[model samples]
Target: MTDSPEEPNPYTAGLEHKPQRDDTFYYTTVVFLVEGTLFRVPRHPFIDGSDVFRQMFQLPVPDGVEADGCSDGRPLRLEFIQQNDFKQLLKVLFPHHSQPQKSSPKTFAEWRSVLKLSSMWEFESVKKLAVDHIGTMQIDPIDKIGLARDYDVQEWLVPALNELAKRKEPIGMKDADKLGMELALKVAAVRESVMSSYSGYPLQIGERQAGHIDFTNAIETMLTTLENS
Candidate 1:
């Protein structure tokens, strides 16, 4: 009989790494949740399986979005999901509310404008609209800050600042301190932009009137928050 070649050992050679079920993976699906609900979503690009549902699958996270956050609620996160989920969320959020005013055609900027107006009026339904759909709103800190300034929404302004502050250390920006300083400068710039439109005076001269001092204080406070946090 011919001698058989020795078989390769399985223990230390020819070992293959198998990904666990919880490995980060992507899936494209219709994403139907409750009865009679459907979400239009693009194919998944990338997302962490560990925090998929809690972090990445949110309505506002644009596709292929990335951010830093744990499975638990933390500072900042970057993530994406389908547009359908976003729309479904809005429907559920404002079931009893009036439909937003129709613009000539739908555009992302239009959507932002609508939200800005709604947020300013403090209409219960409009607030609900933002609440329901803000999760799906793909906005960066600069844009959030700018929009809040342009629209004069005090409520949304500081929170966005704080959110960015909380995440600054984790965002891996080119220079954290410099980034904070730049953001402070941006606050100053926004104050300048809004000053041209300043109307309220004295007693009401605050976020509603492009008050530079207030914006400066807010930016400073955010920097402090990030430093300590």
Candidate 2:
């Protein structure tokens, strides 16, 4: 007698996707593997927040090829990404994203993680949120310069460098180390030139300008020179 035929498994090891888990209209989750960690979270947040993810999810799977993010055995791999950063991103997307602005308990470092990932993924809204949250922070000028450059925060460049050049507290060894040799040197040069130009008779500069030493033009010139060089 002929033996009975076996039923096909819909979960994995298939050439084509056959709707295994979370195939509903609204409730779907994508599995991601990031630096040896596994995260299974809501798929909609990614689709809504990032065009990259939306485009990826929209790509049609070719015949005879397996799709990723299907189950625990197979997950979408996030290369060159820190698991910690992914965790921080998930903290906001999972259930806390709908809450009020700046409501999450994330620290500065965690927000930075969000910034890094969001920037990389082209999550414009999420990136803006990270930037806004960091705006309220009390980071120092030197550190702000570094953060500004790292994150493409153009709004922070002028204020941070101006503070660095105008502040009475001389740039110390620790400050130099923080700003790096080249930037520290530029800041020192600007301060010295400004001090020399207005020695003895201080310029009124302006009423609202107050005690400021007028580092705007000098900083801009220095920045131009730095850029050209």
Candidate 3:
């Protein structure tokens, strides 16, 4: 009699692996690999705050694809992002305090990470919160300008540039490197104009008026002109 075809090994057969439900959490857990570190966080807050995550979760899973969990299950992989940045972002998204804390990020660096990830993921509220916190920090004017421009924080841009313009010392090579050559040159020019025109004039405060030399307006105009030119 013909030898019966070798039966397929049950263990070898392609099967959707599911991890044991190990955690006693109230909500479903979604796992992410950030910079090779595994973070198993709750799904609700991410889904609620991030349009990107919401869309991702709404997508139909492919046939035989296991849901995201641990290795026994499928852990969602987020590549090319630092684990610390992701951790900071999660802190903002899921704060430890039941009520809003007076202090969010203790440092500018932490807020920067939150801003980067929140903006990338289109977490608008979180982005706004990060921006607000960043606004209060004592950051270098050049760095602040960069962050403002990058994140489209319009309110931050004029003030930061004006602060740079008002500085007694001209933009150094290091700061110029941060602001790029074009912006650095523009800032230098504005500083010269402000020094010459106003002499000892204090930095303009409040909203721009019709004819007054408003540093904010000047910065805004300079930026507009640069963009157009």
Write model 2 residue lDDT over 1-229, tens digit each, in one string: 9989978866665657665464456577789999888888878889989989999999999897767887778899999999888877777666455355544536889888988888888888888888899888987888778888887888888878987776766667888887877878887777765643255665442222324465878888888888899
Model 2 pairs in collision: none
Single out the weakest 10-residue window by summed lDDT for candidate 1.
70-79
CA error at residue 175 for candidate 1, angstroms? 13
Q: Which ranges of candidate 1 are over 4 A from the true structure?
A: 1-110, 117-124, 166-183, 186-229
What ranking emerges by lDDT with the best candidate at the front?
2, 3, 1
Quick one: best TM-score, which candidate? 3
Runs of candidate 2 with Cα error greater than 4 angstroms are 1-25, 97-105, 172-178, 196-200, 203-211
User: Who wins the lDDT comparison?
Assistant: 2
Candidate lDDT scores, in order, read: 0.44, 0.78, 0.76
Q: So what's the TM-score on candidate 1?
A: 0.27
| Candidate 3 Cα outliers beyond 4 Å, as residue runs | 1-26, 69-73, 97-104, 195-214
